[model samples]
Target: MKVGVVTFPGSLDDVDAARAARLAGHDAVSLWHGDHDLKGVDAVVLPGGFSYGDYLRCGAISRFAPVMSEVLTAAQGGMPVLGICNGFQILCESHLLPGALIRNDHRKFGCLDQRVRVENTSTPWTSSYAQGQELTIVLKNGEGAYVADEVTLDRLEGEGRVVVRYVGNPNGSLRDIAGVTNERGNVVGLMPHPEHAVEDLTGPGTDGIGFFTSLLESAATA
Candidate 1:
């Protein structure tokens, strides 16, 4: 499988996301934010970063990037896309996923090893894991709290779209949501940084490998 990792201005984790993809035995392509082409990648990842220096709003400016236009279309066409940290903000800004990330309830930047429970493992991005499985990944962000209207939250819960929830309420996200998937389960967004935990030598551990490996396994099944 070939996965593309998009790099926007000020993006800090594009290379790490690509490395994780490669470590999972897939070709990792570096995609530029200004490019409209996807280069025929089977899947895409909008890695964590402070694009445009988080001007206007976190990921608010990046939602208008040329690459995001393509990503939006591809994602609607059932292309699997994973958004992490700042990328998750962009996904919400683009309306690709539900809920909005706001300032942490503590009103401070949080950086720690966060434990998240896999709620729905049927999505293409999480199919490798069993439901209710818990894993720890690096979480670092200033505005990572996820919030939504009660109706929307109900719909998300009723439809089984809530993919991951925090084992501990670290960011004060609503209902302890750490991650979520779109209706079709093709697009997923999360506040934690899985790319930072894909390797044992340089990261916390290999707990993050499933995010990449699951994509490959999903593709094979498809």
Candidate 2:
């Protein structure tokens, strides 16, 4: 499988994400923000970082990048897309996923080994995880709080769109939501850094390997 990792001007984790994809037995491709093509990648990852220096709200500017047009269309066509941290912010800004990520409720950047419950295992990026499984991954961000109105929040809960929930209230998210999937289940966004956990020797653990492996398995089956 070929997985494309997008790199914006300030993207910090694209290299790690590509490495993680390779470790999961995929051909990793590097995609630039200004590129108009996906390079025929089977899947795409929007890695974390302070895109556009987070000047106009985390991913606000990065959402308008040329590559997102292709990503949005491909995602709608059932191509798997995973967004992490600032990438999650971009997904929300692009309207690929609902809700928004604001600053932490405590009004500070947060960094920790976060425990997250897998609420939906049917998505391409999450199929390796069993529903209700709890895994610890690194979470770090200045704006990681997830927010939505009551109606949307309730609807997400009702429809099982909430893909991952924090084990503890780490960022003051409603119901401690850490990740969510689009209605079609092809697109997912999470605040934690799964790529950072793909290597046991250097990372917190290899628990995050499931994410990349799940996508590869899904692609093979498809």
TM-score of predicted structure 1 = 0.98
Q: Per-residue lDDT tens digits of candidate 1, residues 28-135?
A: 999999998999999999999899999989999999999999999999999999999999999999999988999999999999999999999998888888989998
- Candidate 1 Cα deviation (angstroms), residue 37: 0.6
Candidate 1 global CA lDDT score: 0.93
Across residues 1-222, which tens digit of lDDT does each residue of candidate 2 receive? 989999999999999999999999999999999999999999999999999999989999999999999999999999999999999999999999999999999998888999999999999999999989999899999899999999999999999999999999888888899999999999999999999999878788988989999987787677
Candidate 2 C-alpha error for residue 60, in Å: 0.3
Backbone clashes, each candidate? 0, 0
Question: What is the clash count of model 1?
Answer: 0
What is the Å distance of residue 156 in model 2 from its true position? 0.9
Worst 10 residues of 1 by lDDT: 199-208
Candidate 2: segments with Cα more than 4 A from true spot: none
